[model samples]
Target chain A: MSIWEYANPKKFMQTSGLLLPWVTGLAAIALVVGLIWGFFFTPADYRQGATVKIIFLHVPAALMAINGWLMMLVASLIWLIRRHHVSALSAKAAAPIGMTMTLIALVTGAIWGQPMWGTWWAWDPRLTSFMILFLFYLGYIALWHAIEDPDTAADLTSVLCMVGSVFAILSRYAVLFWNQGLHQGASLSMDKTQHISNVFWFPLIVCMGGFVLLFVALLLLRTRTEIRARRLQALLLRERMA
Target chain B: MLPELGKYAATVLGAYALAILLIVGLVVLSLRQATRMRDRLRDVEERVKE
Candidate 1:
């Protein structure tokens, strides 16, 4: 009847199950096409040369790394205010995915940096903030594991998410605020091309789309598992009581 | 066909390789967890029914 109705485990499971194959198929196609096109088809930058090819993976992974945390923040808020079990589990389900994205971005950035910046690492504002954001993600996940009661864990993580969001925002805007970063200004922008050539741009966009779909497919799969695990725990507890 | 990457071939290829490994690893682990939890839950449900 409503969006929240799908939050019911049965509905969520059935709906996601039907959608999984489609999402997975689309993600595979896009990722394959985008990566192949970007890697083999596009011309090397006049300045950065072939090292620029790394942007396809680095930028999208970095974008998703931040967006994933933001998604968890929203989900955590919903759990705290609306008391939705799905929301809490969704937040939980997303953390590992987010963490992986962050790691991907970091690794890719460092690899790219070695060619461009002549260094594998830097303690600049953007890079440092991102590292802090990764630490926040680690702490949030650790807190979830440390608590036994689901509600308590959800509540604590929700508060932590809210708190971590402030630092995340700072991390995102650190380049703008500090202006002392080895990281360059944003490559993509809404108002203009931001120096990204069309040959490179389209494939990068496609890759980002693929990553988004991949994130959704993964979130759905993980959330459903968490729901099933919770259900099993409840059932076992019931059997014991009976 | 693979494009020539000049001197930066290792950097480009290594980044892609690491990304592939991480993404594939995550997907495999998540799917396995889902399958495992579902199977375990189903088994318990069947046992209780008996």
Candidate 2:
């Protein structure tokens, strides 16, 4: 019933199995609808033309890139405080996915930029900090794989996550920290300035939600796999000892 | 979609294609890795049972 109860492997596996199907189904639907709406239904920007459509994917992916790091930071904190094996494993599992999303966002952003800003690369605050965030993700992931001892890996990874969280927040707010160059205002906001019209916003929200769900499903799958792998290693050691 | 920008379209499409391909490849690799580990776990459990 409580979060701690699901810390047990058996309970976690069962719950993940039950939830995976629904998550997959919803993600598929949301992606399809979002792509269709973004590509066709949304009116092209008066200034940017059809290329602006890339914003639908790029924005959501960028948002997730920062948020993924935050989630890892939280998981790492929980693992360090409670020494929950699942928490550490989940943090490890999430690293690759977060890195992938960050790459997508960076590439898509550059592509979008060439047509609008006439330059593929910019030394602006937002861009520089985002690149740093990506580097931090790579470092975190590398640290996990390089460590042979699981306990040491978890401990070091927790410290790295905490350190990375500072950079992640700075990367997210980099635009506000310094006057930005080509990057426009937030596409979707709480105040509804409506940089993007309704037709696109609806589908973009769906895609963003779908992407978050996909991240969750992948993280769960990877964490479960890691747990099983560890269990197998333990058994092998026990057999050898006997 | 850009009529005069046909060359740029190729670049854009290429980037998107590569990203999607990478994602598909990563998914396949992860799924295979998960299943293989699961099978190994089962085997160890069964051996212990014996």
Q: Which candidate comes out best when scored by TM-score?
A: 1
Check candidate 2 and list the clashing pairs: none
lDDT of 2 by residue, A116-162 (tens): 78988898777777888899999999999899999999999999999
Candidate 1, CAPRI quality class derived from DockQ: high
Off by over 4 Å in 2: B1-8
Worst 10 residues of 2 chain A by lDDT: A177-186
Each model's fnat?
Answer: 0.86, 0.32
Residue pairs in candidate 1 whose N, alpha carbon or C atoms collide under 3 angstroms: none
Q: Write the per-residue lDDT of candidate 1 for residues B1-50, one digit (tens) a residue.
A: 67989999999999999999999999999999999999999999998999
Candidate 1 chain A, run of 10 with poorest lDDT: A186-195
Query: Please, what is the whole-model Cα lDDT of each candidate in the order they appear?
Result: 0.90, 0.80
Candidate 2 global Cα RMSD: 2.2
List model 1 lDDT by residue over A37-145, tens digit each. 8899999899999988899998888888888889999999889888999989999999999889989999999999987899999999888888888898899999999
